[model samples]
Target: MTSPDARMLASQNIVLILCGNKKDLDADREVTFLEASRFAQENELMFLETSALTGENVEEAFMQCARKILNKIESGELDPERMGSGIQYGDAALRQLRSPRRTQAPSAQECGC
Candidate 1:
């Protein structure tokens, strides 16, 4: 989390997914599933094991990430209108109200999803 690259990627409230690659070679794994899962949990990232050859969990991973990103947008945790979030919504949605304290989660009504 302290790495500069990781910080940069997370700066815009971007959702992060951690995929452990090479699932087809489970016996030859460089990192175990449990270890990677623990790391993903500690880093607060969505976890998946994928195999390009087998096409395992690849689409599901993308779908899960997209779902969470949309949820973040709906929940007002992310603002695509803000610069550098790399997100855009086509339809008109009312912006979420900013709380003065910046501690409380915005209400669903407030977000206007």
Candidate 2:
């Protein structure tokens, strides 16, 4: 990626993690975990790996990204009012308003009971 792209993404504080290829057993086709980790250390981004076939580490990767964003927010490092800010708690009044429940058909046993 170009410097401008990196800067733009960084300005938004979006966690950009590179997942390398699991196809190569030699582990040189793409960026490895070590390299991503180093990059994360330098750029203050969250780094992780995931496998699509086995469905491994995918959840962990998302959780790691969420935790990093939350940590930045908690530390006052990121402003929630910013456009790219991911911290959306929504309006309190919206939560207070409840949706109407749907009616369901009951079995014959319910009528006797």
Candidate 3:
């Protein structure tokens, strides 16, 4: 992830997730979990190991990413009004998503965090 392309995205304030998929294949692993964890920690990124076959942590990865993005938007770090911010309230869910009642962040139990 230290590549130039990744750096360009970081320059754009993109929220990145370092996902190591196929977590069920522990026997054929080439990279260690500690290595990935250290890299993610050093880079200030969200990381997860998911398994498509077992459906483990797959949904959690997406949910975590969405939560981070929503938090960023709520904190005014990411502006939905700004172009290229990669954030927008869709027309179908706009009203519900932007409802004033949803101002508070979800509880840990609610978010499964």
Candidate 4:
């Protein structure tokens, strides 16, 4: 059963990572690594076994997510201008909005006073 937030994020084409934490306590783990990995594969999500106690794969997990997002953006699969969440707006959005290549104005234009 997927959470409503997960469904919402999935609908937005967001890259998802299924991290199995507490690798340091592997012996006491109820969920086997193979099981988690298989589940992640079935769900088409990146999987990582992380340990907060030892900080194992913690950085790598985040890096993987970032890399996937960057790859999607570079490949034009993700459009920052069209996305409504999970992305920060700054110079890139402004540049895209004011770009000479942009032929159409935004759908909802508001003049901030």
Candidate 5:
């Protein structure tokens, strides 16, 4: 199920990262480093072992993903306006919806109250 999803995302030029987390508990690790690395290589995805507890490689992983996204954006490979791109630039309506001014209720005169 997940493999097909990954393939579909890959086909759509999405950046993928296969993360093996919990490096802080290396002794309790079930999946070996080699296995995870091999899987990531086979799937053509970037691999990282991160530890949220120790903050090891966590920032690197995010930076790598962000860099890839920025590269794609710069190269025009990824369009923020494209459907299914998981990004949306605010249109006028969307901007209005997000604007703080919209939070205020209309005055009684404006509402004809």
Candidate 6:
């Protein structure tokens, strides 16, 4: 199937994050990524990829999506006061998303090297 039109998709405030289940098939799905990325880049729609099996770049992918959504809101792409305006995300959701995660970083206590 052909990739969805980015222009049309970007007109709305919806960001589509598509993750390919099979790594082997991802290469064949270049057109989809190309179209999606192009649409995101041109219209500031967030597009990203992640791997649940490998847990690769999963956080970054979601963060990128969040960032894009935030940017869209900041840019007035979607009305903040208007609920569900063209798939508008809630401020509370964004606030939770922007909150810092409590992750312990590697320190000398944990690393002998």
- RMSD to the true structure for each prediction, in A, is 7.2, 10.0, 6.0, 10.5, 10.9, 8.5
Clashing pairs in 5: none
Report clashes for each candidate as comma-separated counts: 0, 0, 0, 0, 0, 0
Q: Which tens-of-lDDT digit does each residue in 11-105 have in candidate 5?
A: 37767788788999989999999999888888778999999888999899989998887667666677666787765556756433222233477
**Which has the greatest lDDT?**
3
Worst 10 residues of 5 by lDDT: 94-103
> What would the per-residue lDDT of candidate 2 be over residues 2-112, giving only the tens digit for each residue?
255766655666655555435334455466567767876776555556677666677777787777766676666675655766555478564322333325666776763
Cα lDDT over the full model 5 = 0.75
Error of 3 at 104 (Å): 9.0
List where candidate 4 sits over 4 angstroms from the true fold. 1-5, 9-11, 83-86, 89-113
- Go through the candidates in order and give each one's C-alpha lDDT: 0.76, 0.59, 0.79, 0.74, 0.75, 0.60
Write the number of the candidate with greater lDDT, choosing between 3 and 4: 3
> lDDT (0-100) at residue 101 of candidate 2?
32
Angstrom error at residue 98, model 3: 4.8
**TM-score per candidate, chains pooled:** 0.69, 0.53, 0.75, 0.70, 0.66, 0.45
Please give the TM-score that candidate 5 achieves against the real structure. Answer: 0.66
Q: How would you order the candidates by lDDT, starting with the best?
A: 3, 1, 5, 4, 6, 2
**Which regions in candidate 5 have their CA more than 4 angstroms from the true location?**
9-11, 89-113
lDDT, model 4 = 0.74
Q: Rank by TM-score, descending?
A: 3, 4, 1, 5, 2, 6
lDDT of 6 by residue, 52-104 (tens): 76777678877877776676766667565576555544466655433344367
Q: How much is the lDDT of residue 66 in candidate 4?
A: 81
